[model samples]
Target: MEREKVIEVRDLVKKFGAFTANDHLSFDVYRGEIFGFLGANGAGKTTAIRILCGLSRPTSGRVMVAGIDASRRPEEIKKRIGYMSQRFSLYEDLTVRENIELYGGIYGMRMKELIHRREAMLQRLSFTSYGDTLIRSLPLGLRQKLSFATAVFHDPEIVFLDEPTSGVDPVTRRQFWEMIYETASQGITVFVTTHYMDEAEYCDRITIMNEGKIVALDTPSVLRQQYGTATVEELFVKITRPQRTMV
Candidate 1:
């Protein structure tokens, strides 16, 4: 069966003066798949994501996200996707309910629908009592969870998560991935970037980038078999070792 592609990038390139961040990149992300975008620092992962999310325009090549041309319809693309950055974006001065309402309103969600969805999310996270709690008062793990829930509040077709579980404990990270799985099951494409190889394994498919190019892209099992490696971490180290050595 042919899966529907929700993101298509062909010969994509992004250059800042003399430096090329994404060099002739091309890929397709299927509908409802948990797609992992993996790369070492300075590998252009963030640049490419920014372009796809309509925060930045690609220098050249075709990029389509959620059926909108990213280069031409950047604002429209923004409406169809959600983004949760590495640093938490929730306002510490606001209560959980206030943060949710703020983002929901920004996404153009109505008051009635926003309230219904917000309550459901709070209940699902066992956070009904914390609705009025200021974000500054919550723990890091709890804050990260709320950030994710808020990002997807308006039912975007795709959500981009950059190091979504960076500083949390192992147990909290595990719980975070469960939420990711639940989101994918609901047919929301999960586009995540993580340094954790274990979390990479949780992705349905992964694309590894190095030196402004994709060095590997495949399912975890297939990528392991191709590299004759026992784990994704081993394969990642093997593939990116040369770049690490050069630096």
Candidate 2:
């Protein structure tokens, strides 16, 4: 079966004063795929994502997210997408159930549906009793897990995750990816940006950004074979770094 294209960027560009942030970016993200967007600091990944998420305007080019033209209907696009970042975005004073209720309310879920989702999420995260615990009392990993659950409570078609696992332990990171896989399995397209090279392999397809432009875009396995590198990390280095000259 052919999957639908949920996002399309054609020659997208963004600038800050005189400095360009995203330079003629173009790509199509299919539904139900974990699309990894990789870049170092200042590589312009966030700038392009901001434009896609309708939080920032691009200087030029066409960009569509979730089948809506971002430049033309940013508000509609925003309504159908979810966003979570390293900051977690949870209200510290709110408990787990409260946090879910808050975002579910914003998404306009009904009272009955909201309760159902809250219960399901609490059970999934093993937070049945912790539902009443304040968000501030949770550890970073638990906070991030709740953040992920909250972001998807309304079941957005595309969820933009910006370094969602920045400082978590290895086990927590692994568990987070399992949640991402479960999301994708439900036909949600997950857009992830990360500094962790190994995590990129978990994505179905990856686009590597360097110096405000995409230097590589393909499956992790294909990129490894194409670059003759053994790992995603090595392929990334080959794409971003200057090749050594044979002596």
Residue pairs in collision within model 1: none
lDDT of 1 by residue, 1-247 (tens): 8999999999999999999999999999999999999999999999999999999999999999999999999999989999999888999999999999999999888999989999999999999999999999999999999999988988999999988998899999999999999999999999999999989999999999999999999999999999888999988998998566343
Residue by residue across 109-164, what tens digits does model 2's lDDT show?
A: 99998998789889988989898999999999999988998888898999999999
Q: How does residue 15 of candidate 2 score in lDDT?
A: 88
TM-score of each: 0.97, 0.97
* Model 1 alpha-carbon drift over 4 Å, by segment: 242-247
Task: State residue 81's C-alpha deviation in candidate 2, in Å.
Answer: 0.7
- Whole-model Cα lDDT per candidate? 0.94, 0.91
Q: List pairs with backbone clashes in candidate 2.
A: none
